[model samples]
Target: MNWRRLQAVMVKELRQMRRDRITLAMIVAIPVMQLLLFGYAINTNLRDLTAGIADQANTAGSRALVMDIVATTVVTPTLAAETPQQLMEAMRRGEISIGIVIPPDFERRRIEGRERVQILVDGSDNAVQSAAAQLAQMPLDAPVRTGPAIERAISVVAFYNPERRSAVNIVPGLIGVILTMTMVLFTGVAIVRERERGNMELLIATPVSSAELMIGKVLPYVAIGLVQTSVVLALGLWLFQVPLNGSVLHVYIAAMLLIVANLTLGLLISTRAQSQFQAMQMTFFIFLPSILLSGFMFPFAGMPRPVQWLAEVLPLTHFLRLIRGVMLRGASLWELWVDVLALLAFTVAMMTLAISRFRKRLD
Candidate 1:
């Protein structure tokens, strides 16, 4: 090959790249996005986990113990629970990660060398479970008789997964992660593929409106999403022995919401993308952050406030909570209605955007 011909072709390709703003933007944006996500957003050390406190003794000793625990910064006591029942309720609602309970006979039990403090942990998340375990092992210093400090005894009790099995947590989250990976990717290329394959004319020749066409295009993929969900759940139950303590119906309902939300988002990206490559880039743009920030691989309670707010916007984040609540905690959909509502709202918004932006006429 001639050097001149190779240089000429390279220049032609560079010109084409300059004209494609989305591709250009992605080249710059993705690295910065990754840097920000890894540097600031993603945290695995697990700090500031939301905690609830039930100080029954209400004495100086009980308060000092509580202070010592908080000083460790492994968990932050954000809720004031009057009783252990209230603490369980908060953990049940996903409001707190763990509960700190000081018994009424805390000091008395200390004298008798019995357990005084109980740490109730939401064990659905392995990271949070690890944090709870770390907190349990912490030796909080309290002057027993004004001499050298005596170590405070903390008892740890895990709520959902007593065994703390990795599969128990990973399998449920894998459902959401798989759907987000497939459903968005499949439909992200759907409309663009039509244009690339010269099917736009056939579609436009039909009497269907843009909204009708968009809905029809995504319907088949919805079934595919469910099939994937069933396969994962079945394997989880069969191989991993993952528990289905809650209603399977609740799991399906939650899965359906997430499936539709992801499909709509893919369609939205399809409308904006000029080609299958552009669509894939945009899908990755959404997919990467969803995986990182949606509590799929990390504890939601451990993230900073801004990161948590950003995570709350992702469909997977809410779905993770819903699926885990149903499959592990035996929680009904009604009990986790807040996350359900967020998913519903996301699906509707993405649907509206995809339809309104999609033009029946070719670009």
Candidate 2:
């Protein structure tokens, strides 16, 4: 290791590193990305959960009470329900996380020291459950400060996971996380692996159309993804005792859409990556945001408004809603059709984009 020779080697390595723009950019981009995500996007202390009000009381005191809850900023009143059943249905549909049902007898009950303000909490999200639970025991000491500081018991009913078990929330979401990790990792390197192994020439020489090749590449992974989903759901049910109260068909339908979307994303990454390392870097770039911002770890309602809009674009965000809505809430497919449509649209659009990119690369 002569000094001059070592210096020459170092210079050569620096030049090589400089030439790899993706690697160099990622070195800077990843750290900045992590900082932004953890600092701004990843918030565990959730606020502003979507809420509904069913003001059957129609009285000044009841209205005052509703205003008091809103002022707490624990929940934002976004929907209007005529009855508690309708409010519960809204929670089941994943529309709103909290439901305030002020019965017609609220005024009478308040005066009689029994104003049971029914709060229905969607307990499938642990962070949300925790935040909304505060509302139950929260001293409404100053909320209704019109008269003599009258305190009332909040009849908090946690629907879905009444126990507020962490597993109930985490297990269902694990399906999307697992699929995203394995499927993207597996397919992100597919085309790049071919290039690395000197099979690109053979692929180019073959008569297979780009569409056929793209289908052939991703089809096998679809089956594997479904299998992975089965294993995760089964383990979640068996080991964690997490309930699956919805249709098996619904779970698969959502899982398939997510699977295809991730695979296509991987394929798209494959089209751009010159090597497996680059493909992996690109995959990781997406993986972090998908987990952090997709409401898998943090509640979507907790994110800032702009961040929530950003989350809406992620496929995992929509799938989590569908999966949780089905497994925990026992919601019907039609009830969650908006999320269903979102996943379907993501799959179709991503698949088309991946195919076009692959064809362009092949050409």
Candidate 3:
């Protein structure tokens, strides 16, 4: 074992990391930024959302109920549509998520003891729909008295994510983001560092193989990525109350594959880039698409069709599916075979591309 040479390379890499102001900032600054921004800026619950109100009743009781609905912090009456047709058009055009309609016969129906107060809602906006549904269940003026029970012995429970907290969905995806930022950025800098310090030439002159060198460079980051995942899991569990209902080993296995794929991607990027600055820019360029398309901040279903299609190309998309399904849905490997297979394919492709790009002979 050439212990001195290995030690020299390791020390040199560490010194470079410490000396590079941008790298230091990224290592420290990015996480804090993400944590703070995500904590405060990102909210799953809909609040003060606009609703078009069409009140054909125009009666004292109906107006009072409408005013009460607008008074709540969750909803605010915006544009007043003359009819349901106009309100539906507004919802389709993304102008409003919710619309309340009081029919001309609203007071008549209530007087006659008929249940016909219609509430039109756009189910397409899942968050707004959920918030709107809860508001619908609330009676502003008085509860309607039904003559008889429509059914009995029925219990409806929302499954998978019962609380329907967006954090439950977002936390799993954050694991991928952490692994991506750490593994890819570190590995990119590591490979570029070897060449920048003339270590690559020295290594090529020795008996150490390219395969061995690649393995060595990749292992440290893989280990670090695992540590990060563990840290994130702990924080999520204790602070955010995200549950771990599935196999821990399964989470780790999927995580390892994702780390390897990201490391390989970093190595490939480093090989193409001339400097660490370029590598960092390249990483962000990729990171934007990864974060946006992987369904981290928004549901993939809610995104435009073009954006949804773009997200399909990211490895994080599949990994997120595996992690969220396993953790939140308690899905087994058999149920997530497709995602596992996709990740495996991604790992192989990325690693192959990286190894092919790596030059054994210094030039």
Q: Please report the candidate that would top lDDT against the real structure.
A: 1
Each model's number of backbone clashes?
0, 0, 0
lDDT ranking, high to low: 1, 2, 3
Could you give candidate 3's per-residue lDDT for residues 252-280 as a string of tens digits?
Answer: 98899889888888888887776778687
Error of 3 at 33 (Å): 21
lDDT of 2: 0.85
Error of 2 at 259 (Å): 0.5
Any idea what lDDT model 3 has? 0.70
lDDT of 2 by residue, 58-85 (tens): 8887788788778778888899989999
Q: How high is the lDDT of residue 348 in model 2?
A: 79
lDDT of 1 at 206: 89
Could you estimate the TM-score for every candidate? Answer: 0.95, 0.95, 0.59
lDDT of each: 0.89, 0.85, 0.70
Which segments of candidate 2 are over 4 A away from where they belong? Answer: 140-143, 146-151, 359-363
Q: Model 1, range 1-363, lDDT digits (tens) per residue?
A: 899999999999999999999999999999999999888888888888889999999988778778877877888879998899999988887888889999898878777777778999999998888888877775554434311233347779999998999999999999999999999999999999999999998988989998898899889998999999999999999999999988988899999999999999999999999999999999999999999999988667667789899999999999999999999888888989999999999999998999999887787
Tell me the spans in candidate 3 whose CA falls farther than 4 Å from its real position: 1-157
Candidate with more favorable, higher TM-score: 2 or 3: 2
Model with the higher TM-score, candidate 1 or 3: 1
Q: What C-alpha lDDT, on a 0 to 100 scale, does residue 223 get in candidate 2?
A: 99
